[model samples]
Target: MNSTTVSPVAEVGMLSARERSDHTAFVDGGFLYVWGGHHSVAGEEVFFPSDEIWVYDMSSGVWTIYAMGGEIPPTLSQTCGCCVNGVLYIFGGCAENGHTNQLYCVDLLDGMFTWRNVTDSTGTPPSPRDKHSCWVYADRLIYFGGYGCKQMREVTDSRRFITDEMSWVTIGTMLFRFWGWNNEVHVFDPRTNTWSEPQMHGIPPKPRAAHSSATLGRMGYVCGGVEAPSMNIHCLDLETWTWTEIVPTSTVPVERSWHTLTPLSDSTLFLFGGLSMSGETLSDGWIFDVHRKEWRELQHSHRDKPRLWHSACLGQDSDVIVFGGSRDYALLADTISVLQSPSQSHCSDLLLFDTQPLPLLRLCEDCIGRNARTLEQQLSWLPKKIQEKLRKRILFFRTAKSQGTYNSR
Candidate 1:
């Protein structure tokens, strides 16, 4: 996976720049759906209306906002979300009032684009929390460690992780003593609308929040967020409900949080910019080979663009799509001024990273797409499946042209 990076993040001409951070994005049918989170501008933290969603057509390279219909949750930042099939499900986050345990779902392709509050499902829900990561496998949502309130009734399982576990607690005394972190795992099944916590056996990692995660087959990988400068990775086996730590055989990434992890294949994942353990924002990129258990760095352009708390997802073309995050932490209200370097923290730039170059193939495809209609008479000599494939690409290319967002970025 190590190669001299060529093209940097793909830039869009028609898309206006708007700095955003702590947002969430997912891919569905060649389009990227972004929502939630907040951004700071002009030294002030800005929050978007929770009901509005930004849709980016990867095929067309166009951006559109959809004001969703039906119930919308009030929370903004640090919410756990994931898209399974055509449905998007969200659970818990910090809102204007405070932390909440609200479950919201929406169907992106259904004629009715609406969100439904499903918090009152059949089983018990987790406590109000933020900064957790969710993984979807076998049509179920798997949730793990994050910051949240402690439950009184069932101190039976996660009693070891308490709010006072943090030695650096100096502010928010009440929050430090009452609210804390947990390493609990919860499963939500949409088929029957029930929540279940499987009995786990193996030794689990330390309770953490603000970590990154990715789903590969039956295994879910979690990294960092141990409140220390360490590159620790833990893997969860979905079939057995077990956890095992992974020790990379080679060089590891710098300890970071608030970064992104996108799976390139069943055994490959791309890790990007994050806040370092020293409180500095990072711009290095790494590719992890799961089978070999090794980390390889990507020498790419645009390393000058450092971002944290940003959102990234795998695109339809097997490219990595990164969007909306702070370039600096100066505009943050909660972050200490000494921790951040002076720079433009709020960024609205959307970048595409192509790991593998196919310039010749792409050129040919473009030529064919542009003149697909003219060559329709020649399709009689080709197989039906190949003809259908050509037609689909032509339709996609034309859609992008019609949207006026077709650019060679």
Candidate 2:
């Protein structure tokens, strides 16, 4: 077995390194969490600090580390991330010494790394950039405008990562360019592996990085990030490809960057701590309901100092786990936290309600919904009998649901 260590704080509620390690890009298939900044061990400087990826596991409630491949790159702030088919991809950021156009991919299932030469690509990847906005769709990884290295100005370069072809393609350029800003959203079509130019039809507040975007159903929402004086929430419709400016009705989070946004089952997005304009980091949290278009301040609090550039992930049972980053202006080595999902009075209200209660002779709707594709992919993982059983069950659910009798149960 790989060398694994447990945390000293064995409290059932707290997270451990084992759990956090699962958040690293390309860990646990295609699951992704935020990556907090790196710090050193006791009395020792952090090795390859800039190249290290820190992840938090909601299951174990701990922080874990994974070393980046090749020589460690310089320390970078405000990089961008996305996941495609279980691979974690990171793109352009400003290192301590300079800006970078490097693109790296890590496989979560096997813990392997592959670095791509973006500069050498025939399509010409974006110039060395920092503080960009990025996302993944289908199999394409798309990155938008960011601050350029030489000009030190925001640019409109659009680059893509195509997994099947294992190549980088520069799509059409952005309509506008601005850096040190937030509120830009881009979507890619994996089928075509190309990007649509920045949609100007919507009332997108303004272009900004350090903001967060989460997709619920077909709609995506962007919320709070540094925009100078204060932060605000905004929504985008993936279907219409338009923006809806939202005036957060409840106590909202402070404006900041390098924070996290995670999607919950009920179409709610959680916002965690980030760096404030005054250079102060935050530990406070908030939740935004996309369906209702509202925000609610979280009452619970943590003992750890406020931090920025930390990572967060949703785990089984609706628990949210946070991992390492800087606290009180210094990098942190070992810190982890887990926040349980708010209690629900009805079992049917649990996120798993639709997926549970494995069918006996019949197939459970939940099983078919969640595991059907996974089972098909790993047919060899199960015995022939089990595979047959699952197939039978799926057929039953499809027939029942189609007949409209499944809901009667």
Candidate 3:
């Protein structure tokens, strides 16, 4: 975690000349790295793909633009990226002429930052495609559905359903109506440079493109994407190679695509903006507790811009940083916003309280109770329902007690 004190109050800042959309970002070494998105000029209908790399400092709140060494990757959009160890792996995306199958990486370890185009001579690589999903589990990289040449789709134009009441059709058979979807599962082991198409068990997710995948424990969870935006969630057990459908206990997210399903430290996936099937950009955000199988919409109001094709990266101290995406009329936003969690706000309160004067600390000692050696220990005494509330309120006022010392200056 970054040691610098970050305020609990949420902040939104616009980056100059950093406006883009359809980009990919990941956190490595407490810093956020962004790469390969497209930006549109005012009064222009076309989006120019970017090959530049942008780094955001979590502690100092600064952005660094780096001219990467080695063979620079082609300008692309809708790519997938994940951090393995200290290396950032960038996979296939839509290029200028078309989609690509190239895999590139930038080494951040040993302070020798350089790009390397890894050769895949061991086995056949997956088809060249974009709008797919990739996740790093242990030492393997799992790749899933995308717009590609593979004949993984279930149905053709010949299949038709007369009514919604047709219960005889299996899900795999019925989902074939939506073309350009892939149910194939591909795994790449970086250690041996091998690719394996695992014969997965149980019912696989309906083929769809542009979905999000993340690792939780030994399971890989996938959620909502284009062609099927009904908030259907599925998890693949990495151990058993089986798929289990997870139904949320709340109202499902609207049918949408291009949104982010980011895993947070609190065992919840923070879902952000995307585009609905009606071509309407959505600004709503929700948090889904994977363990409890519940969804709760974030009610604290901030800047609400309906966006699609944006990238979201979870930052230090429970801050979900959102950057670059398209709004209505293809207007590209250059803004960066941090969605602050309550735990983060509480964290700030704890920071402020810890720096108070001795007399002030003594005054609040009684209210804090005994044997409360640490914040966690103190919080342990409170009931589950109101523990967080009491923790925040107590910590906030502890700093308020020391305000007069600075105010006098």
Candidate 4:
């Protein structure tokens, strides 16, 4: 079978030049908001929680940076977040010192921009965690499994016991460790100023973190995460309070973590990119039909560029806007790709060269067919004498090729 070169469906705005990964992003009104991640500079990890907010105007496809005000949250990455009514809420994430339980809110309005800590409590909040999944429903934040702090007794404690009491009176001290995974379903109601872990019906999902979640109507769906690299799909019916395992009829992707799932409509979802179990960063895309419970993998130009721990959101024109992530442990920034739905048949308007390697001969042949005139126009930038000689050689080569007398290189 002959393979064909396919360009991106569309190209829009790009992120800033700072290489970053593990950031959070969401769509609010007519803008796309992105912030808070870390980048490596000469083997040093630098976080960007206090960096100016990056905003992309959906209508114009332009990016702008806005300075944040009020008390800014500490530099954080691998955080969980959700958007409700133009307000972006970010929950616990790991900072320079350790994981944090702080909640930060930022308003994305035109004339009313503010950043404030909104963690007031009439009830208990979830413990400090990172790599969690969060969704917005009924004016509340619904948080799912995440990696967080946990306490365990020292190993020696298990060996000591008293025969009479069947327990040791004095045992090894409790030790705190990070990176415990849980399947607790925590809900935070902004109106009630409280957090509650409700009793969910049916079997809960396996304890995993760095999975992806999305809400559609009365149900919420989650898929794939760490600790277990199996392609497991689970759903929670908010109205009925039940968990149901969804067995897909088509191809289910391999086990991966730190990917993103964005709802395109009430019954359709766009899934893309993650770190796979074999230590590879994936760049493939897939579409999940919620009603049919099916998965269809996408083959497009963006498939060659792996993006783990990136952000994706639905754009104004129903295009999926993808932003920063990491590839091969190297942070990626400074570019954004828009995936046009199949309904949009027009080819891409911009051509971008990425770090991913491609077949050079095929790329040149494609350019000769689609952009020969553009290349000819650019030749004017060369010196007049060189340009004239090159133009003559090109004319002679074209004439010879048309007459079937040109020799193969």
> Which candidate has the top score in lDDT?
1
Per-residue lDDT over 64-179 for candidate 4, one digit per residue giving the tens place of the 0 to 100 score: 55666787888886788778777788899878777787888876654344688985666778777778888788888999877665434321221111111111222224234323
Per-residue lDDT over 1-409 for candidate 2, one digit per residue giving the tens place of the 0 to 100 score: 1213322223212222321111223134222234433334443323234445544332222334555555334455556666776556666776665567676555444444333333333333555655565544435555544434333244333222111111112111432322233233444443453434455456655544455556566555565443322456665555566667777666666677657676666578777777676656677777787657677776543523464555555543444545544443422211011111132010000011111233443344345433666556775587888676566555534443443312221
Candidate 3 lDDT over 1-409, as tens digits, reads 2222322122221222256666777787767776766554444324433334566554334455554567557776667778788777777876776668788877655443457777754777777767888867887888877654333353332211011222223224544332244656788777787778787888877766667777767788788775456686788988778989888888887877777877775467878777676656777888788888888887533324555676777654555766666664221121011122222100000011111133654345435522234554657765875565455445433433442211110
In candidate 3, which residue pairs get closer than 3 Å at backbone N, Cα or C atoms, i.e. clash? 155-176
Q: Sort every candidate by TM-score, greatest first.
A: 1, 4, 3, 2
Determine the C-alpha RMSD for candidate 1 after optimal superposition of all C-alphas: 7.4
Clash totals, every prediction:
5, 20, 1, 0
Tens-digit lDDT track of model 1 for 288-349: 88889899998776588787888889875667878877776532332211233445476666
Task: List residue ranges in candidate 2 displaced over 4 A.
Answer: 1-36, 40-75, 118-127, 142-198, 301-305, 330-409
**Model 3 worst lDDT run, 10 consecutive residues:** 345-354
Q: How accurate is candidate 3 locally (lDDT)?
A: 0.59
Off by over 4 Å in 1: 1-13, 151-177, 226-229, 330-344, 363-409
**What TM-score, computed on C-alpha atoms, does each candidate reach?**
0.81, 0.58, 0.69, 0.71
Residue 62 of model 3 has an lDDT of: 41
Alpha carbon lDDT of each predicted model: 0.73, 0.47, 0.59, 0.64
Tell me which of candidates 2 and 3 scores higher on lDDT. Answer: 3
